[model samples]
Target: MADLKVGSGEDIIITSGLGSCVGVTLYNKSTKIGGMAHVMLPEFPANREQGNPAKYADTALDMLLDKLRKKRVNLNRLEAKMAGGAQMFNFSSSNDKMRIGARNIEAVERILQEKGIPILGAEVGENYGRTMELHNATGKVLIKTVKHDDIVL
Candidate 1:
């Protein structure tokens, strides 16, 4: 398992094999600071909520926005980009109700919209998995789908 790394305006953060999940990257151009969160579920676990808040879609977006704000980054200037959210499991399975990936994508979009952030780019929803890379300085997102080529969004 490769580690997801973040950088301040000069480096790129990357994650791979996002199946039935969502990957969110928030970047501050001025400070070149950014972070990426690979969210597996739409909401926080009901039984456990004391650990890292960034592990969840809603809380992670809030936390990322707050960090950028603290660094003097303009909220209106902040742009959002995302990738993943595939239907990885068999629909015939008993766990069909667990559409966590799609739920995660929806949650992320809603959060960004509510915060008034513009979605500059996205590559989400399909049967295939994806590998994503986020560049902090330029807010550029790159996505590589399974058995497919890489794309820069």
Candidate 2:
């Protein structure tokens, strides 16, 4: 479920089957340049040195930013949108670590804040899975859920 992509005008980036995973998008309206990442974990494991950067919120964002920079995107003009991050299954213990969805959301928000990127919209922290679509041309995100109506963020 870990994946990331960057694109320009008219490019629609889509990720499906988001349960505890989160979908994050960064966009620059003026340039019509943006990126999306389907983040599977909150952070990278300290013991690991190498893996798919897209698998963690922290590394995925970093990779996305780097790609955007390579594309000459203005980081100062970036805005963010997010969806998914659902608490897919019920947990018996009240352990925060099991709350992967919430953790993923928090990690992304914190990183965006540290980078001074404002979040323009979000649809997170529910109990159902979601599918997200990023319309790079319009800088709009469409959130689709099986139990709810579609949301445009």
Task: Give me the candidate number with maximum TM-score.
Answer: 2
lDDT tens readout by residue for model 2, 46-152: 99988998999999999999999999999999999998788988999899999999999999999999999999999999899999999998998999988899999
Put down candidate 1 lDDT per residue, 1-153, tens digits, no spaces: 112345675677888878877888776666677767777767667899486666678777776677666767767777678888888866665573577677888999998888887777888887789988887777788998758889898
lDDT of 2 at 34: 96
Off by over 4 Å in 2: none
Clashes of 1: 2
TM-score of candidate 2 to 2 decimals: 0.98
Q: What is the C-alpha lDDT of each candidate?
A: 0.75, 0.94
TM-score of each: 0.83, 0.98
Q: Against the true structure, what is every candidate's RMSD?
A: 2.7, 0.7
Please list all clashing residue pairs in model 1, or write none if there are none.
Answer: 8-32, 9-32
Q: After superposition, how far is residue 73 of candidate 2 from its true place, in Å?
A: 0.4
